[model samples]
Target: MPSSASAPSRARSARPGYRAVLRAPHAGRTFGAALLGRLSYGVVPLALLLAVRDATGSYSAAGAAMALFGLASVLLSPVRAALVDRHGPRRALPPMAVLYSALLLAVAAATARPGTAPAALAALVVAAGACTPPLGPVMRTLWRRLLPDPDLLRRAYSLDGVAEELLFVSGPLLVGLLLPLVGPAGAVVAGAALLLTGALLLVASPLAAPHPRGGDREERQAGADGAAGGGRGRRAGRLGGGRALRSAVLAAAVTGLALGALDLMVVAFAEQQGRPEAVGWVLAALSVGSAVGGLGLGALDRPLPNAVRLPLFTAGLGVALAAAGLAPNLLLLGAAVALAGLFVSPALTTSYLVADEAVAPDARTRAGAWVNTAVNAGSATGGATVGLLVGHLPLPLCFALAAAPALAAVPALRTRDFGGARSRRKSDPAPDPAP
Candidate 1:
């Protein structure tokens, strides 16, 4: 790591050339990849909802299929990351992309047939879940490798977070618009096509090239040596000895649950007022707020210490979300949603950064995958539990309940302070100044 003293000098020296490089065609490819990835995410949820609803003629079944997909993705995330680490992204990305596209086509085909619909939809969900190339993770790893400056890297990740929020807002809207013209099956196919095109561009971009450090190669060779020597148990033990990986996985799970609850709360609150459309507006307000926060954070030259910032922001977010449930008017609820959203992108960005700093360089991709998987898993869990509660209880009660996960996260904020030398030094404090 560069010293604090040299950081500004390095930034001044690199800024002009970095800007020029970022303006090149390859950078456009990076943006394209990001755009497509977000678009695919946006399209998939709506398309799945529509296709499953059309095929099985049940909203519950559709939701179940979506949940299963999330579960499968969570389970497969590590495996996908392992592949990216072992073979390099170039070799790993294409097959996953192809499989993802093919699965969508299969789903489209299944929707056309009445008798075979259920099994096919289930199969498609599983395949889609398994085959989702660790695009977000891979892309993030590439960005880190390509941009060496810590601040620049933070900015990139923050921008990506913003882009992700934009995608969430716009993707579904796009699907809604396209549904009339192309039908649900066609929208699904379009999403697949986008995924394929985006994945290819991402893999081909200059930033996406493999950058295995000397230590990474050594670790790989050692693993191979151990395997060839029939030291399977040793190899397994070494791989499983990743404390950072465990931390990332836990964080992901927490994030997933929190997002899921947030989703349920929004819908439940909207329905409670007999103005279901308010749900969309509230969610949109949240998304817009998150996007604004991310962009503003990214543009900043200085950032608050993650240790201090994360807990404060997250706790504030929890309080805001809780307030939204208690809000009696639409205007107040909208404000609450916006307040809750203000911390979202920042919180997620901090998590990603922490995960990045925690893991070994080569393992970063996998670590990121773990985070994404956890997010999906959490969202699914939140959706199911909150959905069920809303069905049986008062909507505000369900909304209030949704804040539990975020509230639960307050204690975990200390986890962010770990492995930091400054934190350690502060705690140790020179034997309390010799008493």
Candidate 2:
């Protein structure tokens, strides 16, 4: 064994801190591919909404389609994630990508047809959404596999949050650039192409490929089946995370509901003013704020404990949204939305981190899927809500719908149930004064 003199140095190096985490194996390659695939997430909803609006001439119809899309996506995410965890990305991602792209093209074809019924369009959107590649959860889950160290994992999540913010901004900007030239249907086609390409790259990355299957495959698959098995499941094995997982999922659901409304209102704000193309720029402003927040959080040596911060960020989101409701011009609206968005990615990152902490390693993907599920479910609520409220009421008041749920999320975070984390960080007790 090394002498005590060298012990400190060995311990420090063994930390495998944030930089080392990035350099770990296939981390960068896998993440970059997933980032490209995720850009389509920003494009598809808006593209579909615009396409439906162009075809059906009804914002209500467009909203219904979006709600259906989120609903389908939310329902299917967990199942898809479980498949990834058990079988790995190579087997899972490619088939989902293919089916998802096909369905998107089907939706585009229907949009091209002049007289497709509104209900039919909505069904098509749902079908397309159901096929969305489970790449997001798969990628997020990769962090846990790649970095077992707590601090490094936290930093990776923060960086992932920043990347997601960038994806949102760039994805929409891309759509805006193409809108004038290609029209809405063409935008959908473009988004599908990116998603397909990204999915392929993501699977090809060695990081996402299945590890050597010893006996772990059966164990992970078993976890998938028992995750929701109630009280008895909790006692069984690592399969069930019990109350903490539920609480985290609950928080994610509430957060997602609030965001979904904000998305709808932002879109409506531009469309109502006869400058629909400006939606991308306004959203980009919001995402810029989010990126800044995420990066700042990530760069900190010892970031604020996510448990304490998650609720605060979510509440801040409510405040920003409330301010946004009063914005009278595009500039003011962009600023207001950006302010709220500052809290968005941070909250999401915290949720992902919390999910990882709350669940067993085998179920990390499914846990991530639960977070995605909440977001999509909330998106459905917000989209459908704003869709109905768009013409029937003053647009500003509709923002309250988004704010109320967010403020409500504040209470959900009060649960002191998440296990395996200390409520307070250990004090350094006066960092041994330098001699």
Candidate 3:
């Protein structure tokens, strides 16, 4: 912890950068450990897909297993986050990590030999998915505990978002490296090991210690209510009490949907140009643009309030997506996609900020998880929607259609309920003494 004398000087610094975010006591260790664990999320999907396919010898079976795994993980995210919120990370995370790791090892074992039953793989994958630790949400909550200044928190979240994006990108590469040595089954084992180590390190961080103001107070209150006649009112009020949370979730969902559609749209565009292999390069541009945009957001000392910024960023992404459809060539499409990417990270970072601030401390993890759920669910829906429409509709029209949800979300986000000044007043507590 900083000396009392140093706190004032720290506060007076104009704009906290990513460097400052890292410099927070225990911040770097805590965040790095979280990232290490999150890398498993990046690695496991492709690794599992390949492992299953190799074992089952059927693309359809592999697809089904992957779908089951993803669906279970995405759908249960909020439940896992709620566990962390109610029980605290130290109590909640380890058991989840252990269970998930064990399941992954089971998967690896099953895939070690050929002709593993598709039914067995699907069941194992679903169980593993359901047990997947909510490390991302928990880490974001830790950031809140570590950095109370909204500016520093903004920087922290932006950094987190960008790092996560890179992790997902690099995860596949790591599997590629491991493939010759370990094969896909071995890659699955590596993911499990990474997850277990990261989760253990993360929980051990001093920064991840249970907040005095978080779960305990809520649990006590709930017990008191149970003792009296007021039953489950707190549960009812859990994630639905505020307009800011709702808008943040809605915007995140739409933005995710648009981006998901863009992925397929880009492929379609590349194929139409008779250069299918160019898809990776175009997507790389998108990732780079998002990284730059996220860093730019973190650099801002003073920025528009989340209420205004969320809608603005979302709309910018929508407009860019719509414009991308008009590009007749791959170069132009890539450029447009990059432009759209500029809004992606900023929008997501702001949505997380909104979600964090909109809820009570104990509820923050679940709030953030809701945003995560929205994004994943939206992305899935968008990809499926575009898949159905791609051959049936003109490519340009499909692009415009992909952009529509984000455009429509803008006005809903701008309502008085998400009023910038009012929401900030409600959400921004005085900087909690740096833990």
Q: Estimate each model's TM-score.
A: 0.83, 0.77, 0.91
lDDT of each: 0.70, 0.76, 0.87
Backbone clashes, each candidate = 3, 0, 0
lDDT tens string, model 1, 60-173?
888888877767777898788888877777789899889888998888878754555566688788889878777778877777666645677777778778887788778888
Superior candidate under TM-score, 1 versus 3: 3
The lDDT, on a scale of 0 to 1, for candidate 2 is 0.76
Instruction: Write the number of the candidate with greater TM-score, choosing between 1 and 2.
Output: 1
What does each candidate score in C-alpha RMSD? 7.1, 7.1, 5.2
Residue runs of model 3 more than 4 Å from their true location after superposition: 1-14, 212-215, 218-237, 417-435
Candidate that would win on TM-score: 3
How many clashes show up in model 2?
A: 0
lDDT score at residue 231, model 1, on the 0-100 scale: 27
Q: What does candidate 2's lDDT look like per residue over 252-281, in tens digits? A: 776677777777788888988888888878
Q: Can you give the lDDT of residue 43 in candidate 2?
A: 93
Which pairs of residues collide in candidate 3? none
Query: Which model, 1 or 2, shows the larger lDDT?
Result: 2
At residue 116, give the lDDT of candidate 3.
82
